[model samples]
Target: MHHLTGHRNIVELRGAYEDRHSVNLIMELCEGGELFDRIIARGHYSERAAALLCREMVSVVHSCHSMGVFHRDLKPENFLFLNNKEDSPLKATDFGLSVFFKHGEQFKDLVGSAYYVAPEVLKRHYGAEADIWSAGIILYILLSGVPPFWADHPWIREDGEAPDKPLDITVISRMKQFRAMNKLKKVALKIVAENLSEEEITGLKEMFRSLDTDNSGTITLEELRSGLPKLGTKISESEITQLMEAADVDGNGTIDYSEFVSATMHMNRLEKEDHILKAFEYFDKDHSGYITVDELEEALKKYDMGDDKTIKDIIAEVDTDHDGRINYQEFVAMMRNNSPEIVPNRRRMF
Candidate 1:
């Protein structure tokens, strides 16, 4: 964090202190709020505005890499305006997932948030190029209000030549469904995390315990808001609510042990053959080598979100063949291209 000083876009880490169980840093404050909120409030985000935002975002990446730091997580939530002024600088914050690296060095850990993670990173071997890819994703979302990839569905061809037709769903509802898809990825990845290295996930147990400071076995919104500062995240109250709701998989308005694991784990860990195979096995309950709609519904039922319509929609999104079931090939295709809800109606603007 101290290494990011003297950069205009980065959130400066001024000082640090340690209390019994945690270390805290005094960070630069950006009271203007998150990048997404500003875009949504502006109503009409013009290409000119998007270009300026993209430049600032990209500049932050360049600065980080030039300083030998790899900011593994680059999402809209991490960018904030210095103030409510129209010309406030867009500051890049959140270095919790960052690491100092030498030139040509490769990192193997599954870091970064959903949608913004790069393909090579998912393969568990990637260099500074991955941060550039993440910045590109932010640029895409800056213009479209959504990322350009989602589950590698046919319509989401990585090339800039996908179909231009809009979905029958309205944009507002589409946003909601897109958020739903993001949560779905969390649930799916949680299953894979269970079989991963215990040491890799053991930290999460301590994380949950700290957030559940009351030892109540669940993390409330207040606890989450308080605990976030310890982890170097400075989020607005509204953003905290959104995050709490997203991570509260049980809809109980609190994060449980399992929900925290799901919400905190990286969604791109599906690149490993064994990891994906384990997830596929969970869906293919009958060992039929295919994931039927019934099986999907049953799998999602444990989370109480598996209505018939959702099952149909999920299959429609990933089932490339005319067949109703998702075969191993289709499943692999979807997992390999893990990403955000996309609308390919426009030409590549980023």
Candidate 2:
């Protein structure tokens, strides 16, 4: 949980203390009460609302798996709402039963609440799929207002026997939907990558050459200001400085082809659109749909990107709208047109 604290749906770990005899952890406060209690309080919950809740729970579980962590024990009691508002956010809590596992590894443990435990878990051989099974149980309870299986009457099927336990239609539907969504996402990403190929890079190279008014291999501040207007866009000196500071990773005081490509291709290389959006959110800070100078400074501080003056200049270059902030569209354009070079790397899964 400490390593995975930044996710909105996972309870944040604020602090920790360890002593000779005991350990203490401080986590975010959740005031909306337990999932079951909140559902009961409402008395009338719709399928749509239940589905939305299930979606969030699945998302949190997916994040956990992505980070190579497994909750082991997932139940309604372990999830809490941040507030008592109607649209309060839900957060997964209690890492006491969590464990880290590597890709293709399996665990042998009789862990988790009886009602939510998966059959594989009971069999003493399980992986991240166990958490998905538990999530399905939570979805069952969310829609039916009662657990599908209980301690006294647990789900059971003999090994090698045809399944007799009835599966929840809602859960089955959700599984199919998630699989379909995953497939579509992969296809879309492939298409986007194909569109931004070497041919596209060649076109950008031509644009870059046109901007290098001095016939130099790099674009200086003066060239940027004069060249942008030819493309029907005006950029301030400060903004040009910011752009150079951001793209000029080698501290060359100018934007080179590698730096330009890095800035433009960074977001495109991402496998999911949500990843790009999340990257944007990191700099947005206030959820304002636009990144202000202050927000850019805060984000840059993390990367040790540049000093105050240099950071301001990069923001000026990125803020194409001239509205003193970089909106999502402007940000995306900057990413697509002026990105750093991305080295090919394999995606790690665990």
Candidate 3:
């Protein structure tokens, strides 16, 4: 807490204690709940507010990166409002996935929430630049009031293989290997997809204008369900069901405009934890509490497919202590320690 006290954008830490089974951290409670809640309550923010939020986040991330403390777990839930006020200042919180980097160091652990994780992380090698990718997703949510990866149904494969790539990227030179990403990964990449052209943006804006049926500068749930279906895409029934389930935070059958927007905006963050658990499962095939290079290879095979050598290279890089195998605890700690995308303003992460 003391190490984080002076940062203008970080939440103030009050006290902490370590219990036998868990560590308790007590920080200032966010009266505003989450930035996601605020965004949902207001349907969508004004352009100025969205821009302000993005700028502030960028500044915070910039500070973290400069200090070699990356906040890899940035999301709406991790962002708190100064208070419940409409114009409350926001602060970035949560350092569980944050990391500190040394010159020439490379981060190889796979951690962070699913929706916001960079593509490279899924491949098992990424750096601080991954955080910037997540930040971009947040900006998209603030402006669009919906996650970029919002899909209507779970695309389950009978063969248990991952899904084919659905996103288009401009900066990436190679994505042929991405076809093996799971349903969640395929969907998540849409937010960072580069396939969109200027004409597409204009078309999307037109669609948004049409969906803003009430001319309120926001699209309501009623409008979405009634009008968005007109898009002519064959969305899965299960997909819509999952979306509704995800959005109904109060357990109600229907989502209010705010609740709807808030849920979508935070969906990416929700996926992050799930991905970590999946990664753990990948290494714990026998339900054992440890990970072996063989298990890692099998897991990577799902994505690396024809490129088995690549998987071996990644395992060698992460086995920094040169142990023949990694225990679960070691893997977990390594993930917590090596996430380069998380930059915090507090103490350095190693």
Candidate 4:
């Protein structure tokens, strides 16, 4: 909070007193109380009001990020109106879990409230994007009066509008993965209930789009957490984190289209001779017929796959012939294995 002392939306820290046992902060008082109470005292506000609040919330986020600070735990209760006036500025408080971060740094500590935590945080690898994830969820709650993943809530059930768009394929991987079942379970139970149409997966509305404000062409971890509830699937935050790490085949910290399809596509399609060769050719640039360690790093680095050491480790393990390079035969064998595309674990991966 001291780092953000002069920000318009952040609560100003007047002073601090430190003792042997603790440190006390003198903060500007906000007599208007918590945001939820304000909403409940009246009712859900108009979309215009919600839009205004959303902008303010995002501004708080931008203020923090611009100052190299990350508010690790952001939820409705952390926001307070400065005065009783309707237009009083909302101040962001509670820096208990906030931390200063440098660009390209990744935090491993998992600390956040249940509903607003991003999946990457749970997976123990995240950056500034994680805080953005939290703010987006807060925006979703302000707009809908309920968390997006909380399918059991009255607001979720009461919302009966048809889905306006088909979720992206990457989003589908997240929704299906988070549905508390592996693909085999769905197949075993004859569960086509997700409206398994190739054209559109039904029963979800504006789910992924809520946080894709930039439409940057990749699935944000924030979108996954916010969308899971619409599918009526609830899981422990730990499981949600695991679901992301499990599906992120490239280890790029975000799931992309190829990673999604590589992780979930049918075996027949995956093992097609042409498909396997194409996959190899992707890495064996220059049509060299062999994936040298340099070739491996170059290909994987393009996807921001992982560090050089991890990429080299993959090359070493996949080169079954001990040739310091991966040939078509070795590549095919690895791809044919039960689960291969996993970047973290190569002993049993694609």
lDDT tens readout by residue for model 3, 162-211: 23322211101112112222322322233222233343233234334445
lDDT of 4 by residue, 64-169 (tens): 8888998998887899999999999999999999999988899999899777899899899999888788888877756654456634345544365323332333
State which candidate has the highest lDDT: 1
Stretches > 4 Å off in candidate 4: 151-350
Ranking by TM-score: 1, 3, 4, 2
Question: lDDT: which is higher, 1 or 3?
Answer: 1
- What's the TM for model 1? 0.46
What is the C-alpha lDDT profile of model 1 across 164-260, one tens digit per residue?
2222112222223224553345556657766777644434565566568788999899987776665343447786677777777667788777667
Candidate 1 stretches greater than 4 Å from native: 152-350
Instruction: Give candidate 2 misplaced runs (Cα > 4 Å).
Output: 150-350
For model 2, residues 118-200, the per-residue Cα lDDT tens digits are 98988898888999999998887676554565222223434533232222222222222223222112222223433455633
Q: List per-prediction Cα lDDT, in the order shown.
A: 0.70, 0.63, 0.56, 0.62
Model 1 per-residue lDDT at 344: 22
